[model samples]
Target: MKALAWLALAGLSCMAAADGQTQFAQKANATDVERYEYATNLDIARVIHTENIPDDICEVVPIHIFYEDSHGERHTLEYSVMGGHF
Candidate 1:
């Protein structure tokens, strides 16, 4: 029916808006980005940074980590914190 079509269209529009908002938030919340040469050891020296987020709030911290392999190929590890239950 026409009513069902309208409902579907409305739902789709809402989803699209939500997606756009989510993308904007991600871009805005990203705090830092960095890259480093591939390290040989898995020790603490490989750590780029350590951030402390407030444990009491329900928030997310977005981090962008990029690196290159020995083969000269670049890679990305997209990491985020959502309420930090991890």
Candidate 2:
């Protein structure tokens, strides 16, 4: 019975760690997308970039990000200049 308790605890810990890792991955993917988008205007002007990608699949996905300026002016920028597929 004691052994089973230990096993259960260990399993729970592992699951928690896995969940944390998954969340971290998603944030990382979003960051990568932002970075790529920012890089587009790195040599031009000031730009802010961001994205929402699931952590589990973020690493396995190749994201195409472009900059979005919310200053009322409407324009579509190509984010593929710094293209990369995670």
Candidate 3:
């Protein structure tokens, strides 16, 4: 019984860790829009993920980018671009 309890506790801990990592990716709709400029100071180290553009639209649309900075902090940036340009 004690061994089973330990196993269950270990499983819960793993799940908690996974949840924490996922929280880093801000929701697309919840993130603020970031206008791009020629002199914008960005510290992006790597692109973690980019929201997919809808196929039914052909105009400029908001795109959400999830990235990790040089300091290992995650961030989400929302910008507008021509749809289906990927």
Candidates' C-alpha lDDT: 0.37, 0.33, 0.56
In terms of TM-score, the best-performing candidate is: 3
Candidates ranked by lDDT: 3, 1, 2
Q: What's model 3's lDDT at 7?
A: 28
- lDDT by residue (tens digit), candidate 2, 1-86: 44323322433343423454444434444424333333243222212222333344424433322222455331222232222334
Note the residue pairs that clash in candidate 1: none
lDDT of 1 at 58: 78
Please give the lDDT score at residue 6 for candidate 1.
Answer: 36
Error of 1 at 50 (Å): 11
**Reference-based TM-score, model 3:** 0.57
Candidate 1 lDDT tens digits, 1-86: 44323322433343323454444434533344333223322111122222333466577654333333355443333345455444
Output the worst ten-in-a-row residue range by lDDT, candidate 2: 74-83
**RMSD after Cα superposition, model 2:** 17.8
